[model samples]
Target: MRSRVLGSVLFGLGILALVFAGGLAFVVAPAAARLPYDMERTQSVAEAPNAQFLQITNGVAKVDTGTLRSTVTVQPDAKTTADLEGDLDGSALVWLVGQEVVRTDTNEVVSAYSTSYAVDRQTAAARDWNGQWLDTGSNRQSVKYTGHMYKFPFGTEKKSYDIFDRDILKAQPARFVKTEEVGGLETYQFVQEITNGRQDLPKDRLDAILGQLMPGATSGSVAYANTRTVWVEPTTGQYIRVQEKQSKTLVGNTGQSVTLLDALFTYTDDTVAKSADAASANRQKLLLVGVWGPLALALLALLLIIAGAILVTRRAAPTTAPRHAHPRHAADEDETAPIR
Candidate 1:
C-alpha cells in the first residue's frame, strides 16, 4: 500500500513537471521576443582616399562629411505574414524600421532615408512584411539586418548566408570570416561585399542625384559597392560591432568609373558595450528555457517512471504463503477413524 501511494505521488509530480516544461517552452519563453527594441545608432563619415576635387586648399581637400544619426526601432506588430506560421514552427512578428539622417560638420541635414522589415520572432529572419506572397521559390533568402543580425542557432564553423538587400530588393552573399571577442563577448565575424547594386534608377535620374553630391559631375549612370564587416555574438545574434566601407561610383558615358561617395562607418563604443550587456542577459534566459528547463523536466520524469516500475514489479511478483502442518491432535483422531 505504501509503495502504491509513493508511486502515485511520483507519477503525479512527473506529469505536472512535464506540463510546466511544456508551458515554459510554448508560452512563457516565447514572450521573450516581444520586448520593446530600440537602438540609437551613429555612423561617422570621412572622405575616402579615392575622393577627389572640390574643397581642396594647399593640397588638403576639406571634406565636409560628418556624422549620421540613425534611429532604429523594432516593435511587435498586430499583423503577421502567412509565413509566420512556418517560422521555427509558429512565431510572433515584429516590425523593424530605421531612419538615417546624414548631417554635415556644421549640423546640416544633407540626406535622409528610411527602411523597414518584417522579421521572425526568435530568429529575426526577414519575411514579406507587406503581407504579399510571391512564388519566387521556397528557399528565399532572408534579410538579417534588423531585430537580430544573424539567424538563431548559429553554427560554430564558417557559414555563408545570402542576406537580403532592401534597397536592391535582392540577396547578397555574406561569409563568415572568423571568430573573435568583441567587448568581452565572443563573436562571429562576417564579411559581405556588394558590387554594382542595382537601384533601378534611370540614367538621368542617377546623374541628377550624383550632381547633388558632387557639383559639375556628369555620369551615364551610378553604381554602388560596399564592404561590410560585422562582429556578432553567437549566442544572441547581436551585433557587437560593425564596420562598413561603401563607395558610390559613377560610370561616365565614356565607360570610366568615378568615385562619388566613399565613406567608412563604425558603431560607437557605447553601442558595443550596451549590446554586450544585452547579449549576456539574453544568453542566460535562453539557457534556462531551452537547455536547463527541459533537461530537468525529463530527468524528473525518468526518475518517476523508474520508481513506479519498481513498485509495480514488487506488487506483481507472487509471494509464497508459509506452509503449516495440520493440528497434531486432529491428525491423531483422524488416523484412527479413517480405517473404516
Candidate 2:
C-alpha cells in the first residue's frame, strides 16, 4: 500500500513535470525561429527610412549578404535620385530610382534609359513601362517592350523625350485585390505580370522596359527564373515588402521562368505616421512564425524530465502498515514444533 501510494505520488509529479516540459518546449521552439525573423525584420527596418519619401545618393552595395553598407543621404523629399556604382551582377540596382535609371560601370555610363508608366500616383490601374538606352560614343539606341496586360483594370502609357527610335515602357498591371496582413500590418496585395518568353513582345522594346524596371525589382540569382516581389504601403505609398522566390524550369533549359507570388507595399497614413510603436508591433507579429520551432522542443524536454521525476518518487515511497492487525500465537507454534 505504501509503495503504491508512493508510486502514485511520484507518477503524479512525473506527469506534472512532463506537462511543464512540454509547455516549455512549445514556447521555446517558436522563440528560436523568431530569432531569425526578428533579426531580418530589424535589419529591414533599419535599412529603410521612416519618412514618407527616402533617397539614397551614392549608395554602396555589399557583395554578399545583400545588406546596404552606406548611403549618401536620406530625407523626406518627394523626388529622389541616387547614383549607384557597383559590379554588374544580375538585377541588383532596381531599388534606387523613380524617374530615370542609369547603369554605370567604373565611372563610365554604360547605359542610360527611362521607364514608362502604366499607373500613376493615384487611381488603381494596370501600368506598363519600357526601357530605352543611348550609345554615348555612337548615336545608336535600342528599345525593348513586352506583352499586353492580361489582367483587369490595367492600362499602358509611355513618355519619350530622347532621340531613341522606339519608346519602351515596363508594362505591369496593379489591381487592389484585397487587404491582407503582411509583415504585420494590413496591406493591399497587387499582382504584376511580366512578359514570359512564350509571349511575343518586341525583344528590343521588352529589353528596354525590363531595364527600367530592373532597378526596382532586382533579381536574386543569375537564373532568369528568380524574380523579386515589391510591395507598396497603401497608407504611405512607399514600398515596404520585397520578397524573392526560386523558380523551377518546366521544359527546355532556355524555357526557364520566374513567377511573382507575393509582394507588399505600404502607403503613408495617420496611423503609421503618428505612432512608431504600432509599426514595430506589426512587424513582430508577422515574423512570429519563424520562432515557433525552438519553443516546441523546449516544451518536450521539460515533459520528459517531469515524467522521470515522478517515477523516481514512486520508487522511493515507503511501505505503510494497515490500521488493523491480527495477533499471532506462540503457543500454536510450540505445539506444531513438538512434532518436529
Candidate 3:
C-alpha cells in the first residue's frame, strides 16, 4: 500500500514537472522569440531620401478595471516627416509637428503644439514645458542643438533651431527582437542601450526625456525598457505608428510614489505614393502576422501539456476493490468444503 502511495505521489510530481517543462518549451520561449526587431533596422537603414511624411489622428479616454485606472486612446493626428539628408553616411532627421485642425466631433481647435527632432547618429531634440529645448546629442560628435518655438495667434507654431556642437558618428548598440502586425501593418521591434552624459549633462537628464515619452515610467534613469511595435511601410520606409506610454510620477505628502499611464502618439500615412508598386508592396506586408503566430502556438502547447499530465496521472493510479469482495470469497470456500 505504501509503495503504491509513493508511486502515486511521484507520478503526480513528475506529471507536474512535465507540464512546466512543456510550457517553457512551447509557450514562454516562443513568445519571447516573437518580440519585434524593426527598431534596430530603423536605426541602421541608410539615410538616403528615406524620410516619410505622415499624419496622425488620436483621442484619449479614461478606463477603470476594478481598482486600476488607465488612460486609453486613439492617439492624435500629429504630422511627422523624416528626411534623409543624403546617402547612407548623411544624417536623417525625423520631425513630429503639431498642427491646428478642426476636430470633426467637437469642431474646436486644440491649442497645444509640440515637436520632436531626431538627427542621424545623434541625439533627439524636443521643446519642454519651461520653454527650454531639451537636446539629447550623440557622444561621438558631441552634437547639440538649441530650439525655440514661435506661436502665432492664428493657431500655427514655427520652431527655429541651431546646432551648437557636433558629435561623432558612433552608432549606439542595439538588437532586433521580433516582427509584428499592428493595425494591419507589419512592424519591427528593437532594444537599444544608450550611454549617459557626464558632468553638465548626466544620465538622469537623458532618462527624463524617455520617461516623458513612455507611459508609467519611473526611475530618473531608465535601464531596461518596453515599447510597442513600430509599424513601417516596407517599400517607402515610413512609420505607420509610434505607440508609447506616458507616465507621471508624483511624490505624495506621505512620501509615496504614484504613477500614471498615457498613450503618446499614433502616426498614419497621408502621403500619396510615388507609384503603384510601392503601395502594393506595403499592402502585401500589411498582414504579415509573424509575431502573433508564434505566441498562439506557444499558448496551445501549454494547454496540451497540462491536459496530458492530468490524463496520465488518472490512468497510472489503481482502482478501488469491488464492494462484494468479502461475500464472494466466503461463498467460494463454502462450496468447496462439501457439506462440512
Candidate 4:
C-alpha cells in the first residue's frame, strides 16, 4: 500500500513536470521571443571617405567631394507604446529613427531625417498599428512602411528576406550571400542591390537643384542606386555589421547630368563589437527557454514516470512459515481430550 501511494505521488509529479516542459516550450518561449519594452537604444556611427555629394548653401547647390560622417540612432517611440492595447501578443514595440550626415572635412550638414514606424514583436515585420511618418528638413509626410526595417526576426533563416529602403520607400529582397563569422559568432551575410531606383523629390527641392546645377533647364530628377549588405547573427536576428554603396545622379531634361552623391558607408569597429555583444546575450535567453530547458525537463519526466510504473505494477513477496516449528496450543488440546 505504501509503495502504491508513493507511486501515485511520483506519477502525479511526472505529469506536472511534463506540463511545465510544454509550457516552457510553447508559452514562455513565445513570450520570450517578443521584443522587450525597455529595449536598449541603438547608436551607430559610420563614415564614407573621399565621397561626392551635393552641397546646398545660401539657396545655391554645388557638387563637391569630401569625406562624410553619418550618425544613426533608434529608440522606442513613447507615444506609440502608450497607444498600443492588449493586442499584438502582448507586445507594443515601435521605433523612432534619426539619421544625420555631415561633411567630415568642413562640418557641413548634408542630410538629416527622422522616421517613425511599428514592427511586429516576433517577426520584426512592419506593422500598421500606428501611422508611418517621415520628416526631412524641407518637408514632412505620412508614408506607408512595409517589410523589415532596422531589425530582423528572431531565429532568422538562411532564405531571402525583404528589407525596406528609405530612399525608394519600398521593400526589396535581401538575398543570402554567404556564411561568415563576426566577433567569434557565426552569421549569415545578405546582399541587396537596388539598380537605379527612383526617389521622388519634393517639387520645390527638385526645381531648386535643377536651377542651380543646370541653368535654363526647367525639369530634372535624381536617379538613385544602392548596394546594401548586412551580416546578421542568425539566432537573435541582430545585425553585426552593415555596408552601403550608394550613388545618386541628377539628370536634367537638357542632356546634362551630374553626380549628386557617391559614397560607401561602413559601420565602425566599435559599433560592430557592441552589436555583437547584445546579440549574444539575447541568444542565450532564447535558447534556454525554447530549447535547452524543455529538453532537460522532458528527460527528467521520463525517468520519474518509469520509476513510478515499476513501483505501481510490482507485488510484495508472500510470507513464509518454518517446517520444524510446533505449537504449544496443540499439546494443551491433546491433554484435554484424554481427560474427557
As for lDDT, the candidate ahead, 1 or 3, is 1
Worst 10 residues of 1 by lDDT: 132-141
TM of each candidate vs. truth:
0.64, 0.25, 0.27, 0.89
Candidate 4 per-residue lDDT over residues 219-295, each given as its tens digit: 98889999999999988888999999999998998989989999999998998999899999889999999999999
Give the alpha-carbon lDDT of every model: 0.57, 0.32, 0.32, 0.88
Clash tally, candidates in order: 0, 73, 29, 0
Error of 4 at 209 (Å): 2.0
Per-residue lDDT for 253-273 in model 3, tens only? 333433322223333332212
lDDT of 1 at 209: 49
* Better candidate number, 1 or 3, judged by TM-score: 1
lDDT of 1 by residue, 1-340 (tens): 7787777787777787888878777776666543233323323222223322223234333344445443333344444333455442244444534333344344433334444455555555665444422111122333334223334333223676566554455667779999898888889898889986854444555655455545555656657777878777776666677776866666665556556456676666776787778778877886688668877887887788777767755654457986667646765857667644
lDDT of 3: 0.32
Best by TM-score: 4
Worst 10 residues of 2 by lDDT: 68-77
- Of the candidates numbered 3 and 4, which has the greater TM-score value? 4
In candidate 4, the residue pairs with backbone N, CA or C atoms under 3 Å apart (3 or more residues apart, or in different chains) clash, namely none
Q: Could you tell me the TM-score of candidate 1?
A: 0.64
RMSD of each: 9.4, 20.0, 21.8, 4.5
Clashes (candidate 1): 0
Task: Give candidate 1 regions above 4 Å deviation.
Answer: 22-96, 129-158, 198-205, 209-219, 254-258, 307-340
